[model samples]
Target: MKYQDLKAGIRSHLEDAAEDFFMVGYFLRQISENALFTEDGYKSIWEFAKGEYGLSTSSASRFMAINARFSIDGGEHMAEKYIGMGVSKLQEMLGLPDEELEKVTQETTVREIRAMKKRQEAPRSFYGFPKTERPEGSLLTTPGCGDGKYDCFSCCRECAIRQEPRHCRTAPLGNPFPCTRVNNEEWKKNIAYSLYKDECQLLHPELAPVREGDKEPDPCCLNCTNKTCFNRCDVAKKKDEDEKKQSQEELRKQQREAEAKRPEPSDRDIKAFYDWAGIKTTDNITAEDLKKRYKNAGGGGGRGAALQDYTGSARGIRINHKKELTWVQIAKRIKEIQEAEKKKADFVERSNGAQKNVRDLIKQQEEKRRIEAEEKKAARAAAKLQAEAEEPGKPEIIDGDFREVEDEPMDDPAQEAAKTRDERQEPEPVLCDTCEHEGECAGKKTHENGCMGYEEKAQELEAEAEPNPEEYARFDVESILKKEKGYLDGGREADCPAKFIKEHKILVDALTLLLEKMDAEGGAED
Candidate 1:
């Protein structure tokens, strides 16, 4: 026949038998076994299933596997009975024994065969071991002592290892050996040779027996503890304490190497932190406080121990976690702090000089203000004394007070008291000076009773005689305050403040020493 005519006939038959499982299996078996599709103008059998047949790849593969299993059994009648079965049912029927296969073939439908197969294959438990079966008479008797009867078959019924193997001896009645039972005689011989050779002596002591015709015919040497004996039992030696110590040391060294590889804090970051904290040494700062500042500065989370260790302490700061460090940062921060400390004395001296300048400026300003006030008081006193010293005249009043004509100024009693040391000195008086009743004076200059100038001269004499105690008190307070201002300007160097600074420095040094001691102890521990 022509190839086109033959192909058309085959395709029409395939379409008609599309739902027929028997024809599907038959064709799938022929295609797979002979590679018939690849021989007939197709690249592969999968492509042939896609193009020529309407079956999926998985369905085609199942049909092929089921057909191959039946062909191996060489049973045409058996294959015919299962050919009508679905691909899944036929696959389950394959490789089953004749009894199981016959039972599955009696199932008229695919669902019935699947259910029967599932029941047959499903185990009661995951382990598939027989439960609740008692040992047979052979297993009930115990074997001879140390005679290599460790196998569960030769063990007594009371043995713990006689679990599932009891089914082997008890299941098939009247048979000397049941099919379930494995012949362990060959396994025993092989394992016995290895144990007697001392390779498995720790596991099986029965194989290490002292046989007959030996000088010392003991079955076992479990309790022999002779030190100098020529023939002693050889055993595995326990590990030495020195070797354990070496291993621990090596582990610590590995940890140190790992810690050393961690990323370091930059010099810029360290200096910025020191400037913010207002302290020169990071060693004085606790790990937790540093972490707080670090987080506040957007430095993120960590133990902050690496930053601490960067101060070149013997031990890394122990915080919430023992953070790793790099050697470079440790060296960098140490150098930076040392240089800063060296320049600290110069910095303090400059600071003191600047304070002195500020104090001098304040003192000059106060002195200028005091001078200006004294000048104003002098001008007011000169004007008032000149008015009182004016000659008698018709009063030219302004703001209800007499105005004096321009004249030579009169002597002030208070100014005279300041100039002269003598308190009993009285000033010479002018007769009826600025008095309205001067025309009625008979002996007004000399008379004490009726003269107004006589009364003023007497008052000036009394003022010269008396001492003002309040003026001296004001002078003493001003002197004390000036001294205090000087001390403050010198940065409180003369007072208890200097002592406090010294004591605080001593405390800081003591704490630094304590921290160093702790670091040394921790490093020793590590």
Candidate 2:
């Protein structure tokens, strides 16, 4: 094939691919809308596309979006108008408005369409003028050009050429033109006057100047030499006079309406005013005197009334002077003030009482903590004393003096040997003195076979002699004694003294027996 044919073939394939992409988007939209993918054991169309066709979620979503945007009948089918436009152009045209979209053709490049869209979305200048250069209080509703269309540059040009005669020759050619008036030297450099001059010459060739235009033109060009045409113009003077007269007439009408609405003072108000002024009676009170009194009370002469200042019990109270209040209104306001004050006073008293209660509770808690700390200190001291008393061979405090008790002297080895020999030489067995069968037994004959009665008695003694470790582990003697002491000191267990004593005795006996057993075992090991 020729190179041109190859290019043509590639273009054809691209258009076909775009059409195929549109079809895929249409099918995806169908699957998503009808949930058809659920029948194929897929949770969603995106999941189904990814699993079956290896399509990414983003690509699937883009395809669906393109179908929704460009397809006919809400993605049921593709529109024939966009058949050969290709996907790239369609994507770029997504943000274009309907009017701008209609302007796009197959020949229109994506960049041109994008630029057009940006220009349309860009903000227009404020009334064809820069924000900083706009005049304060200028009318925002000024008419546009003679064609009634709001082109920013055209509107500004029309304003300069028609409304402002001074800026006609120097008006700039863009939107947001400078509002400052140009001097003669700057005007000569301005290009707007050249364009205006050319237009004037084209329209009015007969009036075109040979070289120089008028140095100082009149308002009406007919009187070119006269500089005071504006001052002498009857039409302009009449318009100004008419506007002034209308303004004055409106002001007078407003004043008349306001005067009609003004309320007259009643007999009650007059009496109250007299009382407020400290006058004896209203018999001799002149109108001048009443007016003076009202003015002194912050009343105004006309519509611009000042606020009235109250005196006596309602010192800080102020009411509008324009309002014609009777004595009843003033009295009611004073009563409200007094009631509010009473409530505030009650709240303050309650706050003070609450503070006092909090202080008292804090004092009581501090006292309780101090007493508990003292009790704990006393308990530690008592435990120390009890431990010292139980310890063997320790010095005892007698009359505030420590006195060490001397150890018992050890027996001589010779003496111990002699004692043992003496005991062994005795022929007769020792009598079972504490046995119950003592009176009935034949002394040595009954003891020959280890004396069953004596043996029974010995077993009873052995059973009682064995030390029980469980008893020592069961009772924490010092802790129990401290708790009992605390109860006695606090007067909590007054009626339970016998129970305390019994438990104390059992703990002490068990502790003493455990110590003695431990000492005996040490001696045996030695």
Clashing pairs in 2: none
Error in Å for residue 181 of model 1? 28
Q: What local lDDT score does residue 287 receive in model 2, on the 0 to 100 scale? A: 37
Once model 1 is optimally superposed onto the true structure by TM-score, how far is the C-alpha of residue 248 displaced, in angstroms? 20
lDDT score for candidate 1 against the true structure = 0.46
RMSD of each: 25.3, 38.7
Could you tell me every candidate's TM-score relative to the true structure?
Answer: 0.25, 0.22
- Candidate 1 ranges beyond 4 A from true positions: 1-65, 72-97, 100-273, 276-285, 296-343, 346-526
Error of 2 at 14 (Å): 12
Model 1 pairs whose backbones collide: none
* Per-residue lDDT over 457-487 for candidate 2, one digit per residue giving the tens place of the 0 to 100 score: 6675564343332353323444444543443
lDDT of 1 at 128: 20
